[model samples]
Target: MSARPTTEAERLRRCRQVFELAVRDRVSMAVARDRLARERWAEADARLSAKNNTALCGTAAPAFAETDEDGDARLQWWQR
Candidate 1:
């Protein structure tokens, strides 16, 4: 079977999981730090977009994100 992810959102979730799967023999401390840095940057960018993308979010405003297959309000890794 092809390794390609079925959708962009699925690929994103899988990538985030892989990136945060630290504390194992596979990833070094420096790599984990880099991932955290990238994650922080992404959070900042999202906050900015949340203010700017009013049309997309509408009444939900800055806190808007798509529900996953299980219908979760939070799917992104940074979210609780």
Candidate 2:
């Protein structure tokens, strides 16, 4: 039979797997946060007067977009 992987190589592989899993988990958490923030913004907008609603929605949208981009980057890194 073929020889098994050396201990060092096995350890390195396990480490890589762990790192990838961490990245995935982090991305998931960021996405969830973004979702919750958007929900809150929507709720507040519904309750607020017209003038304040515009300002709150504008401030929250960029943060949501940035988190989405960050999550995408992390997913691409994990694939590598």
Candidate 3:
């Protein structure tokens, strides 16, 4: 709110407005507000969990192997 919620009435009014946004966005469905809220929370939690996980890091590139003058064995091109 432009003005701070200095009174309990003002605080409640702002709180209700915030809750109304969820209904407007369909995060709280008309017939199942509580269930929809849970689903919405679960989805947000899952995305946050994935974003913070160590396993999501990209793998490093392998270094090319040194070869002799013969060049018969090839560099690291054929290596796994």
Best candidate (score: lDDT)? 1
**TM-score ranking from best to worst?**
1, 2, 3
lDDT of 1 by residue, 1-80 (tens): 54674788966875666566666547975777677669879997887777456665455535667856744544554476
What lDDT score is found at residue 3 in candidate 3? Answer: 53
Candidate 1 accuracy as TM-score:
0.35
Best by TM-score: 1
Q: What's every prediction's RMSD, in angstroms?
A: 21.4, 27.2, 10.7
lDDT of 2 at 56: 53
- Tens digits of per-residue lDDT for model 2 on 1-80? 32775688866875565556557666554565565557768986777856445565566433333336558779899899
Per-model TM-score, in order, reads 0.35, 0.28, 0.27
Cα-lDDT of candidate 3: 0.63
How many residue pairs clash per model?
A: 0, 0, 0
Whole-structure CA lDDT of model 1: 0.66
Q: Which ranges in model 3 have alpha carbons more than 4 Å from their true place?
A: 1-5, 28-80
Candidate 3 local lDDT, 25-62, one digit each (tens): 76653435565557769997898687445555665446
